[model samples]
Target: MSASGLPMRLRVPSDARFRPILLTMARRVAESVGFSAADAAAVGQELAARTDAVTRKAPLAETTPIDVTFDVANTNGAVFRVRARCGGSDLEVTRPLPLA
Candidate 1:
């Protein structure tokens, strides 16, 4: 992971069915990068919910794909940025994730 937090990417089909896989990846990445256990879990849970919400609202075709991009805004006190995009629709959420 980068200085602030997230440093990963996940791409999956644009269906709601893939949310669990995304959550698992988010949790593992957050924890591996030194986020506190609870914080990591929270981040994962929040991401999953947010992604699902976005998916539900988006008018995506079944063939379209979704992408989850994790990034840090800056090297110092950077916030974790989660961007989910599907079928040209997108949603962004940020978190000031805590260090372990």
Candidate 2:
């Protein structure tokens, strides 16, 4: 809590070093969408695996640094936004995420 006694919230900027944390968040989202734990785990596994494959197969210079954001709200459905800025241009994309 802050000095005012309100709950504190934390923010994490999406970066290469935070991939593992993002993977966990994705898994939790999957589970909340009515997927069984096992299924959610599988999805998370595949997400990580695919990310690894891309990193290994692509040249570093050809890849762009991307950011991920998880926006959770009571009145609005969750939103997972991924943005990549590279090649002298900024690309922003947003996806709707559901919580069961």
| Model 2 weakest 10-residue run by lDDT | 1-10
Task: Name the best candidate (by TM-score).
Answer: 1
Question: For residues 25-80, what per-residue lDDT tens digits would candidate 2 score against the true structure?
Answer: 65676565445777666656665555545455544442355333323333355443
Cα TM-score of candidate 1: 0.76
Clashes in model 2: which pairs?
none
Candidate 2 to truth, TM:
0.46
lDDT of 1 by residue, 15-54 (tens): 6677788888777776766677787788888888876776
Q: Give the per-residue Cα lDDT of candidate 2 at 42.
A: 67
